[model samples]
Target: MTKLISKTIALLILTSFSMLKSQSVKEILKQNGSFRKDTIFSIKSDSKETYLPVTIIKGKEKGPVFTIVAGIHGYEYPPIIAVQELLKEIEPENIKGSLIIIPIANVESFLKRVPFVNPLDQKNLNTAFPGLSNGTPTDQIAHLITKEIIPNSTIFLDIHGGDASEDLLPFVCYYNRKDTPENTKRAHELSVKLGIQYVVSYPYTLTSTEPAKYAFKEATQQGITALSIEAGKLGTVQKDNVDLIKTAVYNMLENSGNYAVKKSKTVNQKSTVLLNQQDYIRVPENGIFYSELKSGDKVKKNQILGYISDEFGNKKYDIVSQTTGIILYKVGTPPVNKGETLFCIGYNE
Candidate 1:
């Protein structure tokens, strides 16, 4: 009950974007422009701060307001690099709609070399949606994105992937929410149009931003056609993953009839595979995890995916597959904490 009250309070106390020093995104969109990119700071303290590096490209013709956000997890490097490539791929004259590109969302974590959480408050930026303005640093960043970015976005992509400790299968996923608005359908369609082959269907039960908890989910709740992509692995910037992200975004912009897309080395997969259910196996205790499986491995029901042992090397639990499916992502490293995700199985019925 206390937690519920706190959540409700946080929802109501969503402060305005007073932290922004430059013109707001909507204000920038109001003007016809060749292109404008700026860094909006989210101030934490006298000496601590983070920033959103945003690029705005308005088309000659009017269309959707597309927003691409990357680097929610600091260790996800490919998505960040992909956004830079997008800054080049998207031309103002050819774009029918405007493009808002955020190359790095968690700048502090990226700069500090933090893995999953922000170095400011040790909080996961991706999990905090519609955050409190007067709260922690992560919450402040979330609030900044929610207030400034989400409102100006008609279509959204929150790109993320494996952190420094995980192995992730490259795939794009759309929210599978019940009784969602038209945004849900459009999001799924766009995920298919991304042309990356594997499309995972993730279930989301929330309908509002306060409870959505994820960046893309918050946008989805706000009636924007939003989805996310998982690529890269173990905090390394793989060229293939970076290219995959760039090509996928280009395909989306091309399908939108807005941007001038260039054909290069991007090979579209022959067919799209629809994976269902976001089956994540999380550990319940602090232990050393052992898994030989990689992302995309097929697993049978009840099969031992891995085992968690204590510090003394005594096995405490065996991580097993609850459903038969393909692994979308898995912890590649051995460190396993309480309530940490071990594997996410993407199943098909």
Candidate 2:
């Protein structure tokens, strides 16, 4: 999309949302495509404040409202950078509908360099969905997302990478269940069409009755077609991972017939399908771990993936895989505390 066309679309969006002023989700989504960025602000004690940075763009043509959320775990860097690149790459003329881009959802976590949880209130942002307005900082941010972002999106993606302690394989995950079979099918199709060879089906778990702690779960349970992507690893900004996410996302939006994106060339890759993630192995006790496997490695049931030893090396116990599958993600760093996730295994059989 050229600059002139882009500006025209922006004008259209601005004109459409001319009466928009409030921070209500409905009002925010109704506005024009002039590439507006808004901050969802939350006040803290002592008059201090934190905010979630969000960019809302509406194309001239209306189609699926595609949303991309990153930086939920602040220490996860690749996805954070990837979303920025996507922001630069997208042109309004090419996009058919609206775009909701969250470059960094956990602002304090990113600023404070915290992993997994928000540094301000010690809450996991990912687990704070349908958040409380009167709750902690993380909760406030999550609440804004649940209320302002997730519900309005037709096709949603909550992007992430391995946090500081993780070594992860790149894969996309979508939900499936008996009760919401239609929702599950739509989500599964989006995941498969995302162009990532490696994919996983979310184990049938979350229900409408449960609290929507996770962003992806929150979206999925609402009958929206949503999926989560894990591409980067260990809080590092790797270029391949960033490009992987950008390309996958771009193709996803384009293939949906919602975007008129024209690419210079096509990326060639092997095709892969969905695998079911069956186990999330956690550390039994605080210890130094020795991993015998890396991400994407295949394993058999009861296979010894690694071991944990006490500081003095006096006591040790093997961390074994309970299923025959691929090591989707594992604790990449040596330090392992009790209850921390050690491995998430996925399988085809």
Candidate 3:
């Protein structure tokens, strides 16, 4: 009798342990301190051995579902750090909504320290949207994210930064001009909460072959409030930008009623360059670049804006502004080809 009782107890304990281990993330959502790390997709190849893991943190109360994705380019570290810190600080007990954080969306490229492009096919993961199940590896990954990861989201924040080729001033970017009022308002509110230097609003072609096919544009189409945030330069992590992103994330969560948190201090946008109807100046030839005026400088029509030169320092071509405007952006690299975008001019009127 004694042996039978001991055996029964052991069997019951083992069964309970097995049940706990095999519980799905959805089942665990019932618990107060629930947090699940799910492998959304897997990359299988000798050249790349990695998997994209998504961490889902559902708050106790019923509220909105916000999905924040980072490391789309793998080299943009500030946004990655920002989202990871948000996951760490989030208390499920106090949360009013579900928060999903995909810290390393491009795990393969992150391990290789390059942009998230397939080594075998050179296909950018971002461009593969509404993807196929049995297509290329990137397509499968994109499909998994679009189907399983993004659909349940009510709001999305896709973060990025300038890669190895360029440096980006901290900015908030949105692609809905005025067609979607709710989404545009939500994006603008988050940008204001972030207190970034620039809040740039633009539009996309809505093409499936574009690089941002699965980005904020897709989210907007699905009725998800989304914003694309660029923090700092790529490859290296900047601590100041990381802090800024963390604070902004927390503020957004609080404002969204996900947590009982303090509001971010209001920041007046006094030094902003409100750009609209901007024009791009194209380079006419391959040459070294020389700028007569800096970005944010005001100029009149027919002004000598900049020039292009050869390696021996002989001037190749002179660039003149076609309208009265402010210089918004200029390319830094030299030997720019003909028809290459050299700079952007923003008109005041």
Candidate 4:
């Protein structure tokens, strides 16, 4: 009996020590001044799961949380590369607030080189923000982000660029809602500090029934200061564009009080407020498309921008600008299909 009692006491002491070790591990995770990388997984459906690589760098001193996300459209390469580089270079000791970077938000789309939508559910991830848990795969991912990530962020940045089939000039976008005037101003200020050449303001409209589902739109609605930065072009990763995006991100870190870099004055950038009736020029019939006008070109109303022709060099139709504005993006490829968007024109006024 004595021997058995002694063995039981030994087992009890080991169990107590194990509990203490577990508690210590938890405490270490809760402490600041370390960088943590986690692969977060979300259930897309009954049999499918999607994963996102998240990097969290916490500073020694407590401050606000800044969230940066990229790769919403898989073919936008520069933003993804910039985010990856940021994750590698940021040091927890040099930061004041925490930095949360999601390098690839849509992993499957990125791996498959899908352009604008997720392959699993065929939904545009950008338009499915604050999504439903029981919805499609893209929707589920957005829902997980809204519930798990956005609430923790004091400021948010959604990085994007032209997809594989688009050519665009770099621009920054922010929501301008009358109800959230303070948040709107903050977002605009952040966009200016982002060091982009063009700032686009997306004002809220009551006539449209389409819900506010864009990533930055949802975040702004939640009173989070958010800006969307766009760069790169033609679905290709240019080194200069990648560096430009990286610099913008660093500028954002400095503006948000996360980094210790010297703050630069907000540069004078052109602000373009998109009119409600902006035109998306679409192809009337299938043919080969040829365009002389590139993105960022000033276009007058009813001006012929390009033409679609038959295989035998017969001109089928002429693509014209509907508004006196600038071309935000033009189709990068020569192939045309019926109803495909050929040009996106933003009004000058």
- The residue-by-residue lDDT of candidate 3 on 13-84, one tens digit each, is 545533443433344345565444443445444443345567777765688877888977776778887777
Write model 4 residue lDDT over 1-349, tens digit each, in one string.
9999986886575455334432221233366555654444444466554555566777877777888899989989999998888777777877886777778988879988998998888889998988888987788878867766777788889999889988887777877778778877877777777667677776666333444577777777677888888898888889877887888878878877888756343443555444333578888999999988888888998899989999999999988777888777878888888987888877635
Please tell me which predicted candidate would have the highest lDDT against the true structure.
1
Q: Which residue segments of model 3 deviate by more than 4 Å? A: 1-33, 36-40, 45-49, 116-120, 177-179, 204-214, 263-274, 278-349
Candidate 2, lDDT over the whole model: 0.80
| Worst-scoring 10-residue span by lDDT in model 3 | 17-26
Per-residue CA lDDT of model 2 for 4-62, tens digit only, reads: 99868855754444334347656766777634455444435344456666777777777
* Candidate 1 segments exceeding 4 Å error: 1-20
TM-score of each: 0.89, 0.89, 0.74, 0.83
Using TM-score as the measure, name the better of candidate 1 and candidate 4: 1
- For 115-186, candidate 1 gives per-residue lDDT tens digits of 989987889988889787888888888887889899889888899978899898899988876677577788
**Candidate-wise lDDT, in order:** 0.81, 0.80, 0.68, 0.77
Report residue 128 deviation for candidate 2 (angstroms): 1.4
Q: Roughly what TM-score does model 1 have, to 2 decimal places?
A: 0.89
Ranking by lDDT: 1, 2, 4, 3
Model 1 root mean square deviation, Cα atoms: 7.8
**Two-way TM-score contest, 1 vs 3, winner:** 1
